[model samples]
Target: MDLNIFREYDIRGRVGPQLNEATVATISRALGTFFAANGAKRIAVGYDARESSPIFAEIMHRELNASGCDVVSIGMVPTPVLYHTVYTADVDGGVMITGSHNPADHNGFKICLGKGTLFGEQIREIRDIALAAEFAQGSGTIEHRNVLNAYCLDVVSNVKMGERKLKVVVDAGNGMGGVTAVPVYQVLGVDLIELFTKPDSTFPNHHPDPTVEENLEHLIQAVTEFEADLGIAFDGDGDRIGVVDEKGRIIWGDELMVLFARAVLRERPGATIIGEVKCSQRLYDDIEKHGGRKIMWKAGHSLIKAKMKETEAALAGEMSGHIFFADRYFGFDDATYAGARVLEILSKSSEPFSSLLADLPETHSTPELRVDCPDETKFKVVERVSDAFARTHEVITIDGARIVFEHGWGLVRASNTQPMLVLRFEADTADHLDEIRDEVEAKVAALIAATAA
Candidate 1:
C-alpha cells in the first residue's frame, strides 16, 4: 500500500490512483488494529457525497468488521454529523470519508477517538502499522444508522431568529451542507435563498472551497439580488464556512472570528479564544480589548481543535473558516452549526455585519499566498527562511517564521496537506505591505534556488 495516503492530520489521496479498494481495505485494517489495540471495540463510519466516498466507506466497513470491531455506518452526511455521532452514540471511535474542501477526485478519512481528533503522532503510528503489514484476524458486525435529523435538531435548537426576520442566501457549493443546512434553516423560519444546494459530487458550480474569493461569486450575487441579511457558504464536508453580509461584502474567516469572539466574551468575560497563525492581528488585539485572552496557534483544523482543548477556550477559529465553539455547543468545527450561531449572535444585536468589521483597525493584507515546493523540500525551505529571518529580523517560529517588522508582519509556512509554502503579509500601509511581500517573495525564491542547487 502507498504510505503517502497518511497525511499530517488525516488520510487523503487521489481516488483511483492511490486510494483504490485494496489500499482502503488495508487502511481500514490498520485503523481497526489501532483501535483494537487501544481497547476500542465499537466504531462508527460516516461519509460525504463525493463519488468515491461510498465505495471507500464500504471498504472501510468491511475491513473494520473483519478486524472484529463492530461498525455503525451513518451513510452519507456531513463530517460534523459524523463527529456528533461519536459524541452522542455508544461508539468508541468514528471515521468520516471526506475530502473536505478539496477537489472531487480526492477523498480521505478524518478519524476521531471519542470527542478528540486522531492525528499527529497517532497518524504516524497508523502509517507504521500499515507499513509493517500487520493484521488481526476476526470478524465483527456491521449496522446502519442515520443521524441527520438528530444533528439538524441539535444545531437549530437554541438559535434565536428573533423578530428581525431576514432573507439569507446559502451556497452549499454542491457539498453535503445542503443536505442538512436547508432543513435546519427552514425549520428556524429563515427566508432561505438556496444556491447549489443539490449534492452533486462533480461540484459543477465551483470547487466546494469557500475560502477563495472566486468561489464566492454565486453567493455574493444571490445575496445582492435577494437583499439578504447574509450569505453563508460551506466547504465540501460542511466543516468550514464563508460569509457575505447585506452589502454583499465577503467577511473573511478572521473577521468572522472577531465578531464571534466579541459575542462569546459578552457572556463569558476573560475567556480564552484561540486563533490560527494566519488570523489577522486585529482579531487578537480586539479580543484582548474585549476582556478575552487570545492565543495564536498553528494552522490546521485538528491542531486548532487540540489547542482549544488545551486552553479551555470558549471559541477558536482558523483563517480557513474552521470555527470551534465550546460555548454552549460541542467544540467541533461544524459549519452548519456555526451559521446558526452567526445568525443567533446577529439577531441579538443591532449592528450590521460589515459595520462590526468596520470598527476594527484597517490594514492592507494579502490572503493566503501559495508558493510551490516539493514535499521533500517544503520544510527545508521554511527552515532556511526562518534561519535567515532569525539573523536580521524579529521572527516568531510558533508555526512557521512570522517576521515582525516595524510596519507589518510576514509569515511563511509549509502546508501540511500540499507541497507548497503558504505566505501572507499584513501592514498598516500599502507600501509597507508591498515591501514585506517583496522581501518574503525574494527570500522564498532564493530558498528555491538553493534547493535546486
Candidate 2:
C-alpha cells in the first residue's frame, strides 16, 4: 500500500491503487484501535457524495465496531456535518469519508479525536499503528443518526437575518454541500438560485472545488444571469467556500474574512481574529483598525481549528475559505454556516457585495499557484527556500516561508494535503507583483531542480 496517502491533515490519495478495499479496511481498523486507545467509547462515522465514500464508511463502521467503540453512523453527509456531529453527538470522536476538493477519483478520511480534527503527529501516529498491525478487537454496536436537520436548525438559530431579503445563487458542483446548504437557505427565506445541487459521484458538470477559478465559471455566470445579491460555491465535502460578488467578481477568502471580521469586531470589539499566511495583509491591518487582535497562522483546516481553540479566537479564516466562527457559534469550519453568516451581514447592508470592502486599499496579487513536487522533497525544498530568503529578507516561518517584501509579501508552503508547493504573491502595483512573483518563482524552480539533481 502507498502509505503516503496518510497525509499531514488527512489520509487521501487515488482510490484504486492507494485506497482500495483492503487498504481502507486496514486503515479503518487502525483508526478503531487508535480511537479506543484514546478513550473514545463512541465514534461518529460519515461520508460525502463520492462513489467510494459509502462503501468506505461501512468499512470504518465495521472495523470501529470491532475495536469496541460504538459507532454513530451519520451517513452520506458533508464533512462539516461530520464535524457538527462530533460537537453535538455523544460520540467522543468522528471519521469522515471524503476526498474534499480533490479529483473525482481520489478519496480519503478526516479523523477527529475530540472536538478538533487530528493533524501532523496525530495523523502519523495512526499510520504507525496501522503499519504495526497491533489490532484491537472487541464487540461494539453501530447506530444511525442523521444530523442534517439538526445541523441546519443550529445554523438557522445562530444566524439573525436582517430586514432585507436576499436573492442568492449557489453552485454545489454536485457535491454533498448542497444536501445541507439548500435546506438552510430555503429556511432563511432566500430567493435561491440553485446550480448542480444534485449529489453526483462522477461530478459530471464540473469539479466541486470552488477554489479553482475554472471551477467557479458556472457560479459566476449564474450569478450574473440571475442578478443575484451574491453567489456561494462549496468545495467537495463542503468544508471550504468560494464566493462571487453581485458584480460577478470572485471574492477571495481573505476579503470575505475582512467582511466577517469587521462585522464581528463591530459587536465584539477587541476580538481575536486568525488568518493564515496566504491571507492578504489588508486582512490583518483591517483587524487591527477595527480594534481586533490578528494572528497569522498555518494553512490547514485542522491546524487552524486547533489554533482557534488554543487562542479562543473569535473568528478565523484561510484563503481557501475555511472560516471558523467562535463568536456566537461552535468554532468549526462549516461552509453552510459561514454562508448564512455572510448572508446575514449582507442582508443588513445597503451596499452591494462588491462594494462592501471598497475602503480597503487595493493591491495586486496572484491566486494560489501550485507547483508539482514530490511529497518527500516538498518540505525540504521549502526549507531551503526559507533558509535562502532569511539571510537578506525578513521572513515569517510560522507555517512556511512568508518573505515580507517592501510593498507586499511572498509565501512558499508545502501543501499538507497534496504533493505540491503552494505559492502566492502580493504587491502594491501590478509591476511589483510581477517582479516579486518572478523572483520567488525562479528561486523555487531552481531549488526543486537542485533537489531532484
Q: What's the C-alpha lDDT at position 276 in model 2?
A: 95
lDDT of each: 0.89, 0.92
**If scored against the real structure, what TM-score would every candidate get?**
0.97, 0.97
Lowest lDDT sum, 10 consecutive residues, model 1, at 157-166
Candidate 2, pairs of clashing residues: none
Candidate 1, 1-453: lDDT as tens digits: 677788899999988899998889889999999988888899999999889899889999999888889999999999999988998888999999999888889999999977889888999998888888787768999889878888888888756666667678999999998888899988887899999998899999999899999999999998888888899999999999999999988888999999999989998999999988888888999999999998999988888888888889999999899999899888999999899888887776687767777888889999999989999999999999999988889888899989888898999999887789999999999999999999989989999889968
Compose the digit string of candidate 2's lDDT tens values, residues 225-337.
Answer: 98999999999888889999998999999999999999999999999999999999999999999999999998888889899999999999999889999989899999999
- Scored by lDDT, the top model is 2
Off by over 4 Å in 2: none
Looking at model 2, report the run of 10 residues with the lowest lDDT sum.
1-10
